[model samples]
Target chain A: MDTQPFYVAALDGLFGSFPTDADSLWVMLIGSLVGASCALVGSFLILRRLSMLGDAISHAVLPGIVIAFLLTGSRNIFPMLIGAGALGLLTAFLTDSLHRYGKLQSDASIGVTFTWLFAVGVILISRFAGQVDLDTDCVLYGEIIFAPLDVLIIGDNEYGPRAVWMLGGVTLANLLFVVFGYKQLKVCAFDPELAASLGIKVSLWHYLLMGAVSMTTVGAFESVGAILVVAMLVVPPNIAYLLTDRLGLMIALAVFFGILSAVLGYWVAYWLDASVAGAMATVSGLLFVLVALFSPTHGVIARVVAQRRLGSSTIEFADSAPS
Target chain B: MNESSDLPPWLEFFTFSNVNVTFVFLGCVLLGMSTGVLGCFAFLRKRSLLGDALAHAALPGVCAAFLLTGTKNPLIILGGAMVSCWMGALSVELIVRYTRCKEDSALGMVLSVFFGVGIVLLTYIQRTGEAAQAGLDKFLFGQAAALVDRDVWTLGILSVLILVVVAIAYKEFKLFSFDPEFAAGIGLPVRLIEIILATLIVVAVGIGLQAVGVVLMAAMLVTPAAGARYWTERLGVMLVAAGSFGALSGGLGAYISYLSPKMPTGPWMVVAATILFVISFTFAPRRGVLPRVLRHFRFRRRTAEENVLRTLYLLGEPLGQWNDSFSTNELLQYRSMPTAQLAHTLNRLIHKALVKEPAQGRYALTDFGVTRAARVTRLHRLWELYLTRKLEIAPDHVHDDAEEIEHILTPELELRLEALLEHPDEDPHASRIPGRFVPGESGG
Candidate 1:
């Protein structure tokens, strides 16, 4: 009975008493913040069709983090952000260069560039195993459970987990960036040439958006890990996309779903006694599946029903109606 | 082997008789080769990142297999990996085909989500305290040093199977890669072939997981093929080159890890493959950056020289003095080329024995230069005439188009243009179109 399967355990926890402990609250807060920040920036990434770029930046930031650790001899947030931000931009630049100048296909260029950078990062971690506190597994799947333990003690006054403060700051920054740059980002995403003709620097907005994504990814990385950060970046936004036609609504919905998954995922992890970040990502995936199949406007089921309704309509009306 | 142990560490590492090293080396090479071969299909289909998605998606499958069988059997685990990888691939296809999600988004979503799920399953397994579940986490980042004889044999057999399937279905795959619609029109079973190739890729990714791990397996599949593309135009040549590159990187990566006990094998393999990609991208004969840049430079220089010679001919046109001298300033007035460039072009022409500095700061066309200049003028005029008379573009609009084409027109194109226009004698602006350069003839 103690060795209950994961699904059964998860079901039990869903109906069972919810953990209201401070630690669990802290974990859920950090998770939701990470989710919100990632979703805010990821909406723009999906709009730009640069979702893979988000993935690439997430992986490629590893070496930057490692190098920053080596140079600073500490895991201070600012240096890590700067290092990872620079490397994130470099990954974007290199992938673009390889695609445009080197004439490699976009996917291959992306695949080659990030994996190479990630490999270098792994080697650095292994070579400096003694000095570096990071490992490949930790980079892939983070230690969210220990977030509360790494308390930010400022001169004997104990604050909560550092991740909460870091993620909150990032989420706020991402919110501001997205809110302020809405018009510019929308134009640039929908039509770069038109945006350029309108005197908006498309590349500037591009890098700015990429910069925001990098910061969000780095902030979320401690709680969700790099791979799950990608999930947070892509899945919720896509789910929102399926539900809405307006960009503003889409972004809002994405953030809503993101936080929903985060809280639900914490409970799931609690029930299954597994990784919190992974459960969050899985819950998001399941959410996306649900929305994809059942959204009113764009869901698969709606489309099929619409098709059947059209098929049964009068021929003259059906012929007159534009597809 | 015992005697070799007393040798220096570096020397001792290279001795092939060491059984463990042999197994590791063979496993990686075979893994590299198979992935490289399967990657071509994916790359051609523009699905390079699909390999990454499949690799990441395999993790939960691996954990699920261990949980189901409660054994550490490699075959069973890999079997589970294939099933889930196939499922991931199917999900990607479904999302792209039926939904509004773009392929890239679908790939990213599936990749990260499946990997997350896998992480959940793996962590669950760890908490369960399954005795046989030791070292399952190695799939996260492969530990190639743990390769034994049985693993080597499995990798070897799988590599051969991938190679054989690719070879036997070579024609179908080539058709499928280049033009699926045409292949289907010709009665080929396009769907079945796609499934087969997808299966092959799934297996290739499956085999590579233990050697290269989930994150890097995409590099093994993509880098070799991408590097090989820069080196060859033919599909057959690309496959061979990619396979060789894959094998070379695998062996090199294995050796590097052998030398440094602390360094992991998978990353080094990726690094080695990337080094090869960089080399190929830079230095391959035709498609490489170096040659492409060289070609562009050469073309620019030729355009400049030809423009100068054509200007000299136009300047001398009214007087009919093909041998008349012209200063740099005079040439720039007619051509708008930079003054310094005109002088440099004159010097190059002098070296070619086509133009001579009859006086300081002044140039004259040699007999050869007049003939070459006439050829350029003629092609320029013929294109203008063709455009105005046949395509109905304004004569003014034709000159700008002809300016670009005059430098690029091959001799065959020049002849074709002349024949099409019936060797017209004058351009739209009333400038006489010069004849083809005949070495012994008088200058036009």
Candidate 2:
């Protein structure tokens, strides 16, 4: 029986009574992998200064999935995802094009595009209630509460949350892409104009990066939900930004932070018996705000503490060490 | 309204279908006027997006007002929206002024943290699930249809008051926007003026939250200013144009949304403003694509004519010669076929005696052509020298642009460049400087 928080399932009852220890193990394992992937993808988005773009994409992808269902006439995961992916690409293209050729400001383009897409989606759902079921209950928070139901059934009893598998696949693909083109992506991210002068096709890199973001978002949405995915994508990378100067380290720290948020979010959600996605997103946002205000390099509290430490250390070192 | 054409009978906007609809349009016009006027100053100051952050900041105030009054009076909510928006504005100003964070970071920080708090409060309210909490969530995504006539009247009056304040302070706002340092030097109360400007922004944003919502209200403020910028450089013209654009968009959006029932008017207004920017970007006379293309086409024609004259001059013909001007087909045989259009261009030149068909197959340079060609070549070599010496252009970088510029150099600019380069006779590779045949300066 699971008689502990998933992380402490190896011991005994810690926070909650689990009927099965294996269930808690599954939760921890799945949550960590999902968190790691969200964090890794989030790093580049934050660094590229498209952190809010993640927020927009997550919302816009909703209508895509809905449209996909209308076309494919089924709720199978893959077709629904493909439809969402296409919509995500369209939103990114429109947003980018508006900022470029349309001469609209980046924020306004983002603001208008996502809201329009969302409104259209909402209107469609209201108008075509019989055709689709994009219930607010399911889309906003996700069915992570029901994630364990759709296990890939083998012969007998070999079951797990279907979401974990989808997110795992996405996470691996994202890792492979970043690893293969880390150098090119880094240069392009830092300075697009200079990268162009060096003969890098900056536009191609932009589409590729946007594609990766879209994929990660859809996968994360399945695992957590659209709202939580944004928090997962935006918060960890932002926290990592506070921690380090190096991109690689920032990415690594972001993943670490992401896992922490996921584990915390799960317990919080369980404790409150509320929407897991909402709790996860809330917890993730709190982590970021805390890091923004208190991380060592630039945090307010860190600065004050560092100053006090410096004052005492200087006096001690001056008496003991040679100048 | 024409919008009624697109709607079902129950929702069709008759004049009396709802007086609230008229109020929405009027309120939008007043908001448009104030924001357009205020936005001109913000746009000039490159702080157009500050309204965006301030708009987001209003969310907390909205939540706080909910917590305090337990009343749904639009007035109480707006008061709260103003307070939170100003607090957010102040936080941003503090971060920028007192800390090392750049504008983007400070803006991002204030926007996210404030909104996060609002979201948490909103979620808390939802979780509490009081029946009244139903409308509480509407603040995130606004409901313009829910607005009552009284609500619209309040917004309308507030907007008018802001419009009056802006009109009266137009000169003061203009002075600070264009040159705050100058205004301060002249003792114009720059800080107080900025504070007033900030307060005006908070008011416009608060009024807009009821009609359009918060996340996008900034577009109402900034888009008109940005679109107007493409049309005019004069401050007065830009302000008027922006106000006019805002008014039209507001009325159109309000009428359409009123008829359609489900469409959000504020976003539609932003879309309309974006269309205006698109029009201006392509059509503005001074920097437009059409004018630039026309300039380029004319320059090409002029340059091709000069090239024909230089070729005849080089071939030692006082009359324009056919050395460079074979038939149109012969001229088309060049490596880059694009250059062959120069023959059609050269034919235009022949009519001017810059080139002439002295024989059936040949063209010769006139006396005027001979001097102009020599002068073009002289200017070409002189510029190469100046680049390699004074500007320190690499030895290899000088040839490409000079090949294009030489044929188009005006006599006046050529004289000035020659003096700037101290009358150099040799290019980077020791080419000859074309001596100026300046009418009186020929003696010098």
Candidate 3:
């Protein structure tokens, strides 16, 4: 019966300047960066109808990261990146070959490959729980609140949370790839055959794009876990695709939505005292629903309204034409 | 560790002596059978991931059911899961139908978002520190060993119910999967049938959730059906094969989990199913990859031998003697095939008694070989003449098309082509067409 208003409490928690609040801020920052980078590559994936491939890659990278950690007894980013990238490309290639040669449908092939890899990763983790640093719970939901504790200190100069720096580098790399290869990616995604006829190596660009996705997935893995990474990779670009036509505008909108979801999700989690990754995914889902309903150009409500107006205008034109 | 140390030995795990292991194994077998059968429809409909979305969507339902009832009854929780998953499936259908979003994107959105809500609720319940909510997290990655006798009974009854429904409506489901429009045209309630099928899938997912969990339940639904597809083309046979494969995987998975107390049943079960899928993909008789590859290799070898025979026949033709032997060097001027490959083909032909070597370097067709060669040449010329005369293709273009067709033409097709060509004696290239030889008669 005695409770503060939800919005006031949420706002206070988001902007409050307590020492513990720094952790929430870092969590939000890392989430935003990861979300942005995921969206950057995810736009191309959605455009190419490879949205499920993003889901597949996110799940398939689990074994790669676990194996990488086992080989090197630390959670170093480089080995994880290399391992996950290799597996991600392998996921794409295997899905393609199974569909082409094994005569399996694309969806079935994806479902088969990712689940098998994920099962292997989970079995390995459970079997060697004492030796592995990561646990199944961490791999499933992630412990982003603890991420800030793992600070990157160089010669007593603290460079903030290691996740923040790792995600920052990933975002920069994704931005560079997109900026330099925008034209080729656009052509290849829209019309692969035309791009090939125009002398562009469609498959090379495809693998390059998947490599970017792999690296981004690995970077985001430690913070959000695999399923939430899938949400981040798919939800934002999908929302953006519903609202825009041009690729450049779509990418920009996707990044904007990603950041918005992260900030809003952080506040929601702080108020509810729940998992931040879950809150973020929830917010992204909510954002998508909102855009699907209200976007001025392609939204359900807008189209319905436009149709009503068109009906009246046509009636008026008919009345005038008869006279 | 202390608890597992007191448990039975590894070999005894399979003996059905332990009440708990027996119940768990039976429950998993039933779960696998129902999901496998229902998944065949999903796979054929090209919506194989629907089960996955439905599984993830059931998470919040389980949590909500627990929060509301404050109990951990499997049936109650499963009921809640079915409702929630059905809502997710319906929303996906609505989204794809009304909006520009495709099914894959819609599936991804529903799966992650609903799971997110479920995670929030689950964490909320865990924080509340209710003793009743202790085993709720097991639904994420299932703990099959925790299944009691009552839970197993509940799962078995539900699975059998699903199987009965599918059995009674087999023809309807078959018609719906192969061609829904025709079913609808015939006044069948196509939409209702689809909903029934979708509900069956969700029910299967709901029951399996406690054993396989949400993350890997899709594997149970997809892998068995996919593996079964390689062994048969009949719907009935595929469904049965898939069910057996699923049951086998489930039993093996439960056994493995029993062997090591720390291991989860869901992943091991998935691993077992994947092994079966790999076996089917590699070794099944008709549609398996190995057989298809072998068939391709055999066809390639046959084509090579036929090409060599045609070449020798043509070379002997220019000398005005069909039975004359020709040297390998002399044959090389007309055909550009690799020498080693040509020699291998020659050896195979000799082994078949189609060709014989009179000297070390010279080869000639035997009486049987001449008759076979004339028949092959007749079919090739007939095709070339058909293309030039009926299709109006130029002579040069007809040769390339006829070259590939010459190896695969069946006898019935050759007869049809001969009848269509009115038994032409010459091709468009002004070369004489070989005719069939009677056994006692010389070359006509």
Top of the candidates by lDDT: 1
Give the Cα RMSD of candidate 2.
Answer: 6.1
Backbone-clash count (model 1): 0
Ranking by TM-score: 1, 3, 2
- Fnat, 2 decimals, each candidate: 0.88, 0.00, 0.65
Write model 3 residue lDDT over A1-323, tens digit each, in one string. Answer: 13977876775667552224678789888889988999999899877766777677777777887899899989887887778778888888887777778899878988888888888888988887898888667655666667789899999799899989988999999999999999999999999999999999998998899889878876787666766677878889989988989999999999999898888877777777777788888999999989999998888999899999999999999999956
Q: After best superposition, candidate 2 residue A68: deviation in angstroms?
A: 4.5
User: On TM-score, who's better, 1 or 2?
Assistant: 1
Candidate 2 docking class = incorrect
Please give each candidate's TM-score.
0.92, 0.78, 0.91
Residue B366, candidate 3: C-alpha displacement in angstroms: 2.2
Query: What is the alpha-carbon lDDT of model 1 when measured against the actual structure?
Result: 0.87
Can you write out model 2's per-residue Cα lDDT over B50-76, one digit (the tens) per residue? 676677677768878887887777778
Q: Alpha-carbon error at A239 in model 1, in Å?
A: 0.7
Off by more than 4 A, model 1: A1-13, A75-77, A153-159, A314-323, B1-15, B129-134, B438-444
Model 2 TM-score is 0.78
On TM-score, the leading prediction is 1
Which parts of model 3 have CA positions greater than 4 angstroms off? A1-24, A73-82, A305-323, B1-15, B126-133, B259-262, B438-444
lDDT per residue as tens, model 1, B1-444: 346367776777677768888889888888888888888889999888989999989989999999898987888988999999999988998999889998889999999899889989989999998777778877656778877888889889989999999999999999999999999999999989988988898888888888778768989999999999999889999999999989999998998998887888999999999999999999999999999999999999999999988888889888888789988888877879776787788889999988999889889999989889888888888899999988999888998999999998999998888888887777888777776765222433
- Preferred candidate (DockQ higher): 1 or 2: 1
Worst 10 residues of 2 chain A by lDDT: A11-20
Residue B302, model 2: Cα distance from true site in angstroms: 5.6
